[model samples]
Target: MITGIDHVQIAIPRGQEELARTFYGDLLGMSEIAKPAALRRRGGCWFRSGAAFLHLGVEEPFTAAAKAHPAFLVDDLDGLQSRLVEAGHECVRSDGEIEGVLRFHTYDVFGNRVEFQQLCELG
Candidate 1:
């Protein structure tokens, strides 16, 4: 049987592990998780938010993922956007909001596109 998405990995330029930490952990507020011994030498970082996980890997001749991305749900739209900007990252507004949801997109330190969304509370 198929289950929900476990994790997603993004390719990044080599030696950009710190950048991944800054954006994914410090700025995005995800907790860093230690990679298994077999994967440690590959170079990258892994983060977790509850059961959801994401991995950023380093590679030569890295290519930016313009279309592929991982979307994160947020509680505060404006606040999160402001915080990202304060951290020196650009948050771009996405066209056509889903009914009862506010959405936006941005790029991570490795230039991978990410969608952020806030669901409207039903009264």
Candidate 2:
């Protein structure tokens, strides 16, 4: 039986490992995980933070997903949004009624959509 997700993979352009590392590691604060010996030569990187794992695989002629992306449940959504904005990235706010969730959307260097969400503040 499937217990949970092993990881979520997103494709990056060939020879863009450094950019991925900078964005996902330094910027996003995710720790880089070592790939298996066999997989190392394939050209890619893996990362983990807490229980979340994200794999960035190399793809030639890569195309970023506009609508399709992953939504992470963050502890401090406002802080992350501010960080991303201060880094010269765009942060779009959501005005929809999605229960008690507060969220924002942003894009990676590759133009892939990324969502950050947290529970709405109780007043």
The model with the greatest TM-score is 2
My TM-score estimates for the predictions, one after another, are: 0.90, 0.92
lDDT of 1 by residue, 48-87 (tens): 9877699888877899999999888878788989998998
> What are the lDDT scores of the predictions, listed in order?
0.85, 0.88
* Model 1 stretches with alpha carbons more than 4 Å out: none
* Model 2 TM-score on a 0 to 1 scale: 0.92
Q: Looking at candidate 1, what is the lDDT of residue 105?
A: 91
